[model samples]
Target: MEQKRDDTARDAVPAFDWDPRSEEVQADQIAAYDAMRGRCPVALGAQGNWAVFGHADNRAILEDPRSFSNAVSAHLTVPNGMDPPEHGPYRAIVDKYYTPWRMHAFEPTCRRIAHRLVAGLARDTEVDAMAALAEPFANEVQCAFMGWPETLHGPLREWTRKNQAATLRLDRKAMSAIALEFDGYIREQLETRREARTSGAEPPMDATTELLGEQIDGRPLTDEEIVSIVRNWTVGELGTIAASVGILVRFLARHPDVQGDLRARRHDAGLLARASDEILRIDAPLIANRRRTTREVEVGGRIIPAGERVVVLWASANRDEAVFDHADEFRLDRNPADNLLYGEGIHACPGAPLARLELSVLLQELLGATASIEPAGEEPRRAAYPSGGWSTVGVRLA
Candidate 1:
């Protein structure tokens, strides 16, 4: 039967079916999303936006960028928030940074950072993995990748916390302020590089400095554009990467059989990579990504009108039982293409190569260095919306 669209759908708002920010939903995001997928796959959220929960629906939205646009925000977001034609040039520049050669060259530095952090983890005692290892690993690796100094690590970590807090509260004012604060950090770095170049003191040819020489449309990228690009990259590294570590460690700590298998295959990069991706698929690190409807569209029996906002729920879709048998089961045999961990389509994460490298190396080092990692006596705290994984992953490393 053909689905009927209401004539007033263009102006009429749909009644919200779920409160995404409610205490109930936030308490157990994965379970709540799972229920939502079954009850209302395309839900009208309390935030006045639609949350697409089904895997097929989410994939369709991601692939059909024309119907669902990426220009969801008014503020400049470089390639991430731009549609095609406009997004292509900036994306080209971003992709160059994460090429095979770059990832291979940066592997030693990444491994070194991971090894140092893993080595410092206390053995046979309860520790908050997020603070003791995950956060620091992400911060140091990100800083090292961009040629940022140790001084920025503390500030960057704190900034990420504030950013997540502001986002959860939907505090636009606070978010704007935090955005400016981060921009200041990037601006200072850009200025320092420019000053060095002008004063005849050679600036380090790091990622930041390399951005200075990048050209688009025959003109050098503007400072604003550069800062936006770096800001996007920094958020990806600091937020999602850290959450992924917590998830990976917690999963390994709980699943002894899988942990034992991965520990044995620590030297096999391919197996380790697939294992990390599979684990993260079971417990997503990034909750959802935003999009706007360019035209009226039907998704999972719901009609989202033109100009409306939609959130693609990665946490929900990746674990949809329809897509994967026993969605929560950690199986290495699952097809990699079906996993939306790094996303799909044109707007897929440009930093996936770098992210995969960091996670794979960190796991190898962590598994190689420790005899065992298991959950502590204390309960783990789940991160709220806009963030995924545990906030305090209480675990004992031995």
Candidate 2:
């Protein structure tokens, strides 16, 4: 049967079935999401948004972009926010920047940054992995890759913190302020390039500069479009990259045998990459992605009307017990295609190749630098909504 719809859309929808921001949900996000996955796979959430937790339901939404539109936000999101036909050309542009050749070319610099950060950690002391390792690794590598200034490292760090806080509260005013603040930073880069073009001075030929010259639909990309593309890339570098590092380090720390096994096979990049994906599968580095229903749809036994908001919870779906044999167990034998770590379908993460390279290099460097990495006395503080992984991962590096 097709989805049944009410004449009136959002207002007619029932009140939120679950409170996503309640203290209970924030206490332990994975556990809470798992509970929802079992009890109500397609749950109604605050603000008329529906949270799809089951692997099947989430996969359905991801596979059928027509039914679930990507235009969920009012703000422009470049390729990510645009649905198909329009999404393809822009996606092609993004894809070229992260091709195998490009990643291979940049691998040395990425390795150097990762090595420097890992080597500098104080020995025989407890270090917050988020600070000494995760955040800096992301900050430095992003700057190197984008031809951005090292001075941006601190400002971007603060921006990530502020952005996360504002998002969790769903504070539109603060979120708008945070966004404009980021735009100012990007605008400065654009202005500098414009000056370089006028004065005949050379600006670094990097990703940002390349974007300024990119054409779309036979016309040059607007500053708005360029800024949006860069903003999405920023989230990947600052948010997901840092989160992945903390999660990777903390997971290895908790599983000593796995850490030892990885240390022994450190030179085997493919094996190491598989292990990284498996670890992240158990604990996702990204919590969710939003979608707006394009038509009335039935998902996981729930009938969602057209124009309703929907959220695909990666943290929950990747760990769905139905898909993976031992959902909670970290094992490398599982199929990579089944994992939604880099997502699936056309809107899949474009920076995946770069992400893999950065993480693989970081893993090699991190394992080589440490005699052992073990959890310190304090528990790892989990980051709340809009951010995944630990906010502070405490570990003793010896």
Candidate 3:
């Protein structure tokens, strides 16, 4: 039976204080999500926030952007932090860049990069997949998409690492410093492009150039705004891709039979992509995304007052027994029609198509190139963030 809300209970809701940075705490996140889904789907969180776990309730909150605001920070997600009407325009700019044609154009480059990375690992007996393969693969692809030099990969990776640390700290000073560093870099690049234009050289088709061409709210985007958008992508992409690659490889290694089947059905890359979604459903990179409640709303039979923070536990919701049968098992045949890995509604990740394309291509390349993959000696190191996993992954290729 679901718990009912009371005036006394409203004053003090039973909640869990989760320190995402702690390894032990991070390990317990899944268990916490499970327990919350089983008993109190909408419980109070440590920071006095409402945590929503049930699949239906989480979907409701995500879909109803008016009831739960996404505008947590300005200058950083443009409209990822915006709601509905305000979000539409900014999102259009991003959506255009991720159009199927544009992503398809990048496919050859993506596949070449994946093949090169895998080839590099071909000689090594045992490798840290995160560093040797995933990081470089993602960094290079991101650089290619931005039309930036591959030389920027090192600095970009370092900056992403620093930004993740700063975000986890939620420190204003560190964030400001990082912002300045990125701004300086981007401005210098813009100036160089301007100079090159005077020489009659055309700038490359890339996000930076595209953003420079975009008009938001009927005004051209400023350098700071462009930097903020690019910075968000750079900071968010690497870790998740690295973690995802690790998870996929680990999953394949554990189930060679499934790997063989996918390899045998190479013509069904789309099916493989769907199977990848199921893999994500079983071990979602992100545990939860935070939203602010607009007013008093009843979710999972509990009342969340206005001005309260709501943590939508997508990881839990994807595995909710009410929504998925045998939610804990990894089944490649499972349909991902309702998966929440990329989230839902207006704020759903706009770069999802690009990400999916990249992951699909990467897996396809791997299946074609390698005979088999088996676990190496070392255990993988998981990231501290709720959205992160596998700082280091050990794997041996057959």
Ranking by lDDT: 1, 2, 3
In candidate 1, where is summed lDDT lowest over 10 consecutive residues? 1-10
- Residue-by-residue lDDT tens digits, candidate 3, 86-166: 788888887888888998898899889998888778533777777887888888888887788877888988987787788
What's each prediction's TM-score?
A: 0.96, 0.95, 0.90
lDDT of 3: 0.78
Off by over 4 Å in 3: 1-23, 74-76, 122-124, 168-172
Per-model C-alpha lDDT, please?
0.92, 0.89, 0.78
Model 1 C-alpha lDDT per residue in residues 58-173, reported as the tens digit of each score? 99999999999999888889889999989998998999999999999999999999999989989988988999999999999999999998899999989988998898888999
| Clash count per candidate | 0, 0, 0
Model 1 TM-score is: 0.96
Off by over 4 Å in 1: 1-14
